[model samples]
Target chain A: MDETILKTEEQDFIEEDICVAENLVYHKPKTLTDTDLHYCPGCGHGVVHRLLMEVVEEMNIQDKVIGVAPVGCAVFAYNYMDIDMQEAAHGRATAVATGIIRVLPDKLVFTYQGDGDLAAIGTAETIHTCNRGENILIVFINNAVYGMTSGQMAPTTLPGMVTTTSPFGRDVKTMGYPLKITDLVAQLPGTYYVTRQAVNNAGNVRKAKKAIQKAFQFLQQRKGTCFIEIVSNCPSNWKMTPVESNKFVEEVMIPNYPLGDLKVPKEEQK
Target chain B: MGELRLMKGNEALAEAAIRSGCDAYFGYPITPQSEVLEYLSREAFNRTGMIVLQAESEVASINMIYGAAGAGKRAMTSSSSPGISLMQEGISYIAAAELPCLIVNVSRGGPGLGTIQPSQGDYFQATKGGGHGDYKLIVLAPSSVQEMADFVRLGFDLADKYRNPVMILADGAIGQMMEKVELFEQLPRGGTYSKPWATTGKTKDRERNIITSLHIDPRQMEKINLRLQKKYKEIQEKEVRYETFKIEDADYILTAFGLGARICKKVVEIGREKGYKLGLIRPITLFPFPFKVYSEIAEKVKGILDVEMNAGQMVEDVKLSVNGKTRVEFYGRMGGIIPTPEEILEYFENKFLKGE
Candidate 1:
């Protein structure tokens, strides 16, 4: 040894060893394409997409599952998810999913929609598709704002939350209260399973993934409309960093949208 | 073997849809066309495993059609005038997305729910691209119960061929009237055409396809519009269908479609009996509007009578086709009232032949 400080290849050796060990702990879901996500860094959409792909890959139903993409932030979901996808008109994901399910009843059909796409313009479609008991999975992302259209007030936006359209904070007296669409949909007899969840932390992320998995499982049983409402975060629209947005979801958003199972089959009820 | 049975135009069209191997029918009940949904709901599922849904409203029905059509299934919806108006927005989206589907407008009178009786007021809405944007539907104006049944299969074929929505523009009279219809044999499922672009599901062999009308880039959107325009041009050149009666050595011509053509045909016979030298041109496809035939007739005939059930809606197209080369006159009945052949002949004799 020359006694001069020499950088060793030990760092590379250690990294390789750790990666081999980590292989048992974590791996990218194969259903997710290699393309990098286009979602904002702090956005919850990426996490939701990953959870969905993970479920898809783990279930080994990639070829049989068809997804309907809504016309919001998740519009480009087809680019990242390796499954077949149909892009629906604004608020028409449930309708589109109903179509796919009807024509290919053997296939697993799911719709990924935003709050605006579900509770606003597509309200009739959402309500009727559920009422009709279409055996499909609906993953509704309630971010309290229209993330794709740049912070416009959504039907799920908090009563007092400030948005671009409600710059002075939402006035419930004039603008009407935020819609409890999950609760409303749960009342429909056609809906067999309904849940409201959040993905703010690792533990919550695991729970949200479970809920989505349950929804798909119910659809497989042809139990009827399986709806999973995920109250997520839009960090950029909320004017916060990813860390702060996660914190906000815990403190402020959770109070407005509590996470739990809203409805289930009588036998599975808890 | 195919069977011939007496059927209401609406029911015949519904039967024809099932025989055409239509995958789905999503609709709401509306007068003059409720038989379509009622018949399909009662029979389509048991007969062919077709999906028939009674949607919440016309808006929901049309959106459901958009969804099914996007999945590369043959879907259809039917409504009267008011319901059809509610469907225009969804129809426009379907058109923009380039999804193939069938829409039957068993038209009643309208400006706003005017009447539940027969009227051809939706002629402008149909041939002019009812919803919005620079778009067109392959509008087939069915004048008889036979045509109503025949056009269902024809509409689906044309829609599949062009990847565009097709409209069977029937009126209340034709939709409600019962006549003998020769039903076609059921075509094999998946028929003669294949949808390579449909969003059925993704297989490993091909990249995932997205059915969308959204192209943020203006240039890209313009290219889509241009593509649709070129397709429409091809349709115009190849699918311009019309029937000419007694055009041999005629001095006056009558142009009409749907119920209007039925009345005009009678008027043509009446005029010819009176030795006024009259003929009729019934444009079967309202969109590809027989303009070439009209242009040719404009030079040979001295005048043309445009008859319609509304306040002279199709007359504008008639004028455009004639281009002031020969005199074109209009005679119309309004608000759910059907024009009589005698009145139409009187209007024609007084307006165009006599130059009154």
Candidate 2:
């Protein structure tokens, strides 16, 4: 058993290397831990996690920001994000975040949730948390499917889309129209910054990263709830290759769910 | 000792929580227990920096406690039967996560919205794992307004000591009744221990703290279960609490808890007045039940009467403890009914002495 123990280099134990400095233009963010993420190739969860942690690192608030992980595919987000985190029950991330922020109002708090966890089972908590204008950031991942559950129909699944639960193709009339919860929350007075972005491409990734940065900055300013919804893709669950998934995200998903800032605070208010 | 005041059980509990220097309270309005939320709303913030928020629902309130407990804070919530039923999912998560917090159940009649009146119908749900999975909640039954005031501090201490959820199981009778209580002096916030493993954010000196109940591997899950079981076994050994009266020379033993115990005290006196020697045993810690006393006393007593306000709930535990050494009879009311001492004494006499 002792021989079977495979010890790897502990975080930059090989940092004094002679040949590795010049060629590297960018490196992994310090906010991300060394643990391998379990997300599949081309999965948007990994990118979002990276972007969120990158923002946490850039803002120098890595020691102050506490995250709440959701119950969907990102349930193990704490393992990768290298921040103090509490794993929420399915759809209760916002409520859990509320608890943390209320107890220690000085700490920066945020929650990362998927569509099923956020828009479906946790709809009440989400609406009320936003309505209360909880002074925290909310990162919503709308992948249109329950990726962890192998492509079940989520509340954001498009009309006529075929999923495991809606195998015969989702009927908008029977299955209920695909929910645009971001649009609904944007209308609420509690939201200080509400935006929708995608990470299916390089440009989109940069924009999403900026949204995350502003979300944290707004939270630091003690603004009301900062909600950012990301249009993402599921490759394995979508039964498509990584490239095909990205293409599908652009051609099909983007048209259905347009990406832009839905609600922004007034310039004078900031 | 702090100043004494006449207070309702729910109000006393809320006031005690404030004095205990609790960090936050997340609660919802429920009958027989709404005063707890109301009292805290009026007093918690101004007295100390304690946070008081009326959550969206019982489900939200319990998860809020979970979040607060994860961060190593003293947080609590109170609700009645139906609301508690709604909180089962979050309670199960908190239990599995091994987070310490307090939950008060001002119990009422259940089985699908039975009544708003006090009932002990939640015994099986409280003592037995009310939620899913194999978990035992440390249950403290408060019988009076004074105990209600005292148990808030005790519950928080026990929770932090074991890093497990502790529940104060009171009922509508206790929650609504008014009695003079000598409150304890105010303690500092966050209680006795400094939780090093709390998810309070990662600093440069320590690794990140992750508060989660998820263990996808079967072996890891089994190990978590075993750890919880070991902790529970230790609690069973060290935390068994009960109060016994006149057991030195009695032939009959009367077993009850909370209000049942208070009523049984009267029944014991009534029986003693009628030339019958009777004793009473009230279990304070219901989960780490005084199983040894019940089993040992079974040898000396001629019979035991289990009194409750539900359909033979706690009687099952009593019967199991007695294990056929002596007759264990049960007499109780259901659907928010409380039997008088005369009624209980008559039933005992008819069953044991008259052999009816």
Candidate 3:
């Protein structure tokens, strides 16, 4: 019994040494509230939210930034992020953000929307706000299916991907092609920077954080719409474990989305 | 008078909005009210540095107003009936969020794009919660060009006071017709009003402010509805405004609003000349309805004639106000038709005075 106790004490000492402050590599972003996240376990939304809050904290614009939340899974974003937020009607975030930035021209504004909200109901607002060159940032999360409404077909859903609405697996002939909305938005003259990213792993999460930071900086520069499309995963609705969902995103989603900067300002053209 | 000018009611309202220190104007072109957008587009930017945007559509314009107003900026949008119909959803959200904003509807005839001419067909839609839910817009009916200019400030003030959307309900005739107007002095852009509810930003001094209408919990949403109801009741008690035109010792009353009231004023004078004892009650604020004034006049008058440019929408409110104490009759000219003063007088002679 004493030998067992000594062995346990030695193991605890090793863990304590490894977990010391000097060895700590990461912590929660300052902008994220202390409240536990309401997102599903292993869902990409929490990671995206954390990365966004981290970027906002790193940029030190917490006091000057206003965010518009969409009517989907991220609807409770205001409760999680310690920033002023306007909850927009389905697909009206960009329009609402346009209104805010127009009047309070000194403030930084961004809209966080999902594929269903941005690509379907909010098509007009999304297209026109960008066309008007409103200096705002838009962070789009495309998870192929509607996560909030329990896995319905989305505008960005793969042509043959099955959803509740498409019970028999989406037939391309009937379901039509998945919209490449980011590409379409890049064609508009009002957009200054447009990129597609993901957050499936540590490296991708870092890239997405950098993209969000740049989009916000572009808004400060009075550049037109700065758009970042994040192709994420919906493990719970995808009916797969988080690991399998991550694998699906890597193998299937990336081929369809193809991450990279689709457009950049002339000065940053490369 | 600050400065008397012969201005169309639409242009006068636009000028008044500028002087009221509107921070932004997002509008789309619609007939009979197009002059408002044009005038603001030409004048507001240079005069007050107001943000004037000709939105792609009225849907976009109202949403823009929603955004700007959410940021605590004084914002407005002007549209005719068809455009206003498109704006109903955004207006409902604005009302639900309790954001202060102004909407001026220079109404045209419409069940659907009926005409670009003068009509008060939208009385029901205006006063009785045109948008969904238990929401009420402070509906102000302006009778003349002077009132059009005057109500612009009043609408903004009442909207700010209630933290609700306010509407200036004018018909196409009142919007297009030119008359003398005395413009009010400009209020400062950041006036005395403080908007702590606005989603401006999260300053260090206060917690973050959220502008939202969504309450997933039914009990919580009911509380919001009740709060809105309490505000509407308070407005009804405090902001009931109507002009009594020679109602003392009158045998009958002519109830009308906006351009209909303008015509009814002439009818009252001519009916008096004909020895019919007709008086007019002009509703300045249509939603508050001035129901108490009706009760006060109910004993003096034998009957009431509700005149409108619709097929008798406000007459229902008139009947409810009179409560069958006095006989209530309605005469209307729909599909962009405006009843002449002579026609109204003849109707008063035949319908109420002579009891034919």
Candidate 4:
């Protein structure tokens, strides 16, 4: 049995590509390799991870980038990214990034956060950090549900979406409403660029990579905070298969929270 | 090398932190210690681009320190009693992560919004564990404005030596009162002591380093604790610092720290003039406790008078250090009331001299 497993693992490794291509650019993704990812199958987090690494390699910022890992499902981001990373307390990635950027102003600093981690527990930290006009990039992953803790409703969960806590469908009368962070943060003058994108398909994935690259580039230009909110799918938490999750994201999530650039300064506008 | 200048204790501490080449200052305004923040704010931007941030709250100030220290910068924060209590969680996190930084606590009356007068009620919190955890801060108790200035520099050096958080424990009297002081020369900035372990940026040649206190395995935590204990033991050997006065050939010794020690100094002077052999053991490093010196003195002294602003905190440590080798007694004034040297002398005359 051990011999058979090793043979199949080797075959799978051979099948997996050593490099990735996006927008007519070929880049080597970091060695995510045979280490079984802790993410649930068909989760959007893995796709986001691959896209980010591809950007890191393509822009050749792998050496100059510092990643602030959140305490959500992405807590184990250190295991995937080959670049320098630090794990922050729940919802404190921005505060930690503020410190990092203040000390090493030249380095590119970015934080990866989830809806619950960023919008719920870390709301004050996130808001104050943006308000401070910290020269850092923020890649916010809004999956609308808590994936790691097993199907819990997050602050960005759409209205009427049900979870373990909001079992009978999130009641607008009691649970308030889903949060639109991009729209809220975009109102602040300190923000250099704020955009909301999705990752349900290859085309959206391409757009996300471009947005992330641009955000990093803006930070390199000494512009203010650049935030990219990536609307993502959580199949395991949504209790739907991979394909159904993508369909739900397009048909439900996009309509309530439309995807587009919510804010871009005239100087930063392309 | 120069003439003495009359300065508030808080101002002295500010000058000392600057001279020590401190990289950043993050603080919120509180009474009795507000001048420390004010002085730092004025000079911070001029000298080598020192970062001084007037944070929104005591909570934000300490968290900012956490961030700066994580980047391997020598940062500090100052606050009074109530504000210090609010910073306990951040302090514990800094201690657990073993980050080097300085915290100044100008104590006032406490146990919930007491007077702004001087008080040693924070003795237990400062000497023992103030925050939740099995950890200790390298606490320095300064008796005078001169010591306040001197200890700020020493606190930074000690923190760097042990890679641990250090606290300069003062009170409203030491913080508010003005006294003569001789300032030291400033240390050169842009030295070679850079934290290579800090998470500044990711480069291709290095793997990303993560700074965290979370440990899932119990055994792993135990190993970490043991490592911390070993480091603390080393500190005990090398960093135990104190001052002794009139102790040789004395029949009795006065054990005190901070302002209490200053009052005790006066008591010792007058007690000796009256032909009673009274000495003093003033602990500069409260965490190290100067146990060896006190243990040795126990063999020669008849008893120890543990004087403090609180009812009885350091007396417990004095008693433990004496270990029944000598009789240990205590005298205290609480709730923001400071005891003068004359009152302490009268206590010695009435409590020990008259009784004996």
Candidate 5:
């Protein structure tokens, strides 16, 4: 074996080739536009949207997918997704998905919901749809605070967290504790996969993409309800900058709500 | 061609739905209307792939209907008094979206969770807007099991014809009573029944479509309202259906619908036997309200007797259609108490015969 040393020009060429190969291999999704997004400057919805579009393109299911948009900040998500999309009433996306799937069984169905939509007024629809074993994917964004409604306390707001509705720091005696939707849905036998991931760092973002991919695969297999709850950060609602919001998510939200798979199929474990 | 069978009105409605190529049904179990859910549940998954779901609540069931209708498939739901109230929001959404679906309201006593018995209390709710917004459901009032089956088919056709919701405003009496009905065969699926505007899936040939009612611009909303009104006008002119009784040279015309219409038939016979010049006008389509027939009768007859099971709801419609040309009198019984034919004849005897 002969050891070879690379020249400076060769090293530069290798770096340039790596960059070109990366562009060819992991191309950006065409579903998104370069125009400025409507989200706040440091909002996590943009990241989630990009990740979802990448999954849609990678799976090559864009033509056959239908997204049920929610009523909050993501109400206009239909404008971004290239697939067929429907906007549902504030908390009735699951019900709408049930209708669509029952009619068009071969198409992929997914819903993007915030914590308030999934855990509050739409609790019955969300829980019952999962219990009924509807073959659909649910991407629940748990930001611990309501962003669209001007910084109100969401159902996932932790104790001691302050919000418009919880000015006294979410009094446990009066406001009750935060809701754990992933854990609650994990108990149902109809749910095939249930996981919680965050988006505060690159490692967690990679983990979130994997979780989303698995959820979509589960749906493709006609397995039951696959739910991926992302503990997103709302820097605008938290009254912090982007970096500070990521730090708060890493330091505070993860401790109160630990991240990991709460439920998974036994056969897939090994 | 089929065999004649004795079936309850609710059961007949369920069978009619299956026969009319209804692919999906979402409903919650409620009193006086549970037979519909039961029958659909038993037969929905058998021959063709019919989706019958017992939703968590009436609200969820109607939203499911909204979803199914949005996909451009034949869908339906059924409920009674209190449950129909819960479905108002979803109904409004369905109407606003302009999706073709069927809804059945088996009326009972109301104002709240009233008793589950026969009453004509939901006339205003069905013919007028049950839900919010300026919308109309093509209201068909079926008096018997035969009409119940017939109207289900007619309701679906009219819904698709006008691209709007159609309702079969039956009552607890019609829902519970059994009658002989000739059942029709199921229409073959995937024939000529695909909606191009439905949210099936994105295809390269067409741009993405959205089914929504939110128009922020005042002028655009007005244009949409104008188009909807034009559709309603066309429906009114083309889809008016009714049954006429002996009204030539008659002095009084009795008008009613659903079970009340059946009772009015008997009242006509009793009044004829009693030598009273009383005819009958049975409205099959309640929203259209048989106005032309009423206008003719208003010119020919001396007065009109508007009979119902509730405290005078359809009387308002009768009066409006008559347009003050003829005197319209109302006789009603509330809280699930049905009016007997003799009671109505007696009312005619006292209020019209002796008073005249």
Candidate 6:
């Protein structure tokens, strides 16, 4: 017991010896709380959460922003995000965000939603809110499967992809083709900026961060609905290791749902 | 009289909402209640800068109310029977989150779009837990255009006082019928109460506040349920309200609510002219129901007649109030049919004083 105590003390001392500054190029933003995330290993939700808060922190608008969390895997996003956050009912985050932004027009607002919450049940709300030109940022995380409920086929699930619901792979002839909701919404005049991004690699992560920053800037300008669809991966649901799942996202997901800006403001046209 | 004017019940309620300093009104177009949305749209926005939005559906409207109320704004929505049915899900969430808001239901007959005519059919859905969990709404049954106007302020106050949703349950007839109403003086927005628990973007001086009803832990969920039950119990003890007509030394009592009670008022006079000692009991607050009055009246009255537009929904509550000490009978007109005062009196005499 004495030796164990000595070893623990020595380990503590060694840990203290290794300072945080040496090669410490990155750290969590203060806009994120101290609560440990309940996300599974290698899930894109953690990175997205970090990057979103980092942008909020960088902009120095943490106190002036409110976020609505959807009723999917990110339902407890309010637990981690250190802002005035509201947890919305299933498929109602966009509508909930609409309410907030309408009441507190000057306060920056955003909603983080998963595909099932946005594209399936909340499609009408999402469409109407965007159509009404509600000035808010909508960060949609489309992983192509319902991660929280265990790999159910989502509205964005790729054709021929096997999910728990689609036991024999998705047949578009019967299950209907995957919806390109962002593509659909980009055509609306209310959408100021609409982009499909990915967080599969270091480079793509940077791009996603930039997109979020631009969206927040647009929100500050009151430039109507800004949507960012992050084509993320759900490793646990996809039945692959984190690396394999990301490789699948890069090779499979991107080819079908192409990344990059689908729409931009009129002044920034071309 | 502060701004006395003759107005329809729907118009009076809308005018009252503006005067009560409501922060936002979100609703959809449904028959018998569309006037609420139209009235607010025509008169509210340009004057008060209040957010008035016509949502896509009752589902959208209620969720919008959830968001606005969660942010500590005085929010509300209005709809008829089918529309209120669609709002039940969001209403449950609002109640669980303990956000103060008002919901007005100018109810129509429904068992799936039964009719666009008047109804008190939603008594059970309004008083009982309408959604998945154990929760309650402070239900106000407005019988007159004046009550329709007056209850808007009272509903908001009760909602703010308890941090729970308050519902104004009216029927199609009351919503359409015009009567004299005195609107309250305008109150400034956000001046009535301080919202310490609102998710209004936490500032430097305060800790962040989260508005959510998702409690993952069973233990924590039970604790929340207990807290809600305690609040409901307190409301029941304090908020019981009833309007009586000639109850002193009466042998028979007539109990009804909303327009049904208005009809019963005349029934009381009709019965008295015929030498029957009759009185009327009108429940003002439906959820914190005037159960005590019925219990006390049961000690002396021979019987009680529960008149309603629905097929005897409130009769169940009337029975519970009397607790079988005295006979509680029901007389109902179904499918949007409004029984006349003479018809109700005849039914009462046939049911109670027959062959006298």
Clashing pairs in 2: none
Error of 2 at B128 (Å): 0.9
lDDT of 6 by residue, B1-356 (tens): 69889999999999999989999999999989888899999988887888899998889999999999988999999999999999999999999999999999999887898999998899999999778789999999999999999999999999999999999999999999999887889898754789998888879899899999999999999999999999999999999999999999789899999999999999999889999899999999998998999999999988888899988888998898899898888888888899999998888777556732
Looking at candidate 1 chain B, the ten consecutive residues that score lowest on lDDT are B347-356
Candidate closer to the true structure by TM-score (higher is better), 4 or 6: 6
CAPRI quality of model 2: medium
Instruction: Please list the residue runs of candidate 6 whose C-alpha ends up more than 4 Å from where it truly belongs after superposition.
Output: A1-23
What is candidate 4's CA lDDT for residue A89? 67
Model 2 share of native interface contacts: 0.82
lDDT of 5 by residue, B1-356 (tens): 68699999999999888888888999999999999999989986796778899999998899889888888888999999899999998888888889999999988888798899888889999888988888888999989999889998888888887779999999988999999999988875422455888888778788776777766679999998888888888888888888878877688999988888888989988888888877888888888777889887898887899899988998887888899998888898999898899999989888765655
lDDT of 2 by residue, A26-101 (tens): 7789999999989998899999999998888888998899999999999999999989999999999999999999
Alpha carbon lDDT at B339, candidate 1: 84
**Candidate 2 second chain TM:** 0.98
Estimate the lDDT of model 4. 0.84
Q: What C-alpha lDDT values do all the predictions have?
A: 0.88, 0.92, 0.90, 0.84, 0.87, 0.93
Residue A16 error, candidate 4, Å: 15
Give the distance in Å from residue A93's predicted Cα in candidate 2 to where it truly belongs: 0.5
True contacts kept of each: 0.62, 0.82, 0.83, 0.59, 0.70, 0.84
Instruction: Return the interface RMSD of model 4.
Output: 1.9
Misplaced by over 4 Å in model 2 are A1-23, A268-270
Q: After superposing candidate 3, which stretches have Cα over 4 Å from the reference?
A: A1-16, B353-356
Model 4 earns a TM-score of 0.89
Candidates ranked, most accurate by DockQ first: 6, 3, 2, 1, 5, 4
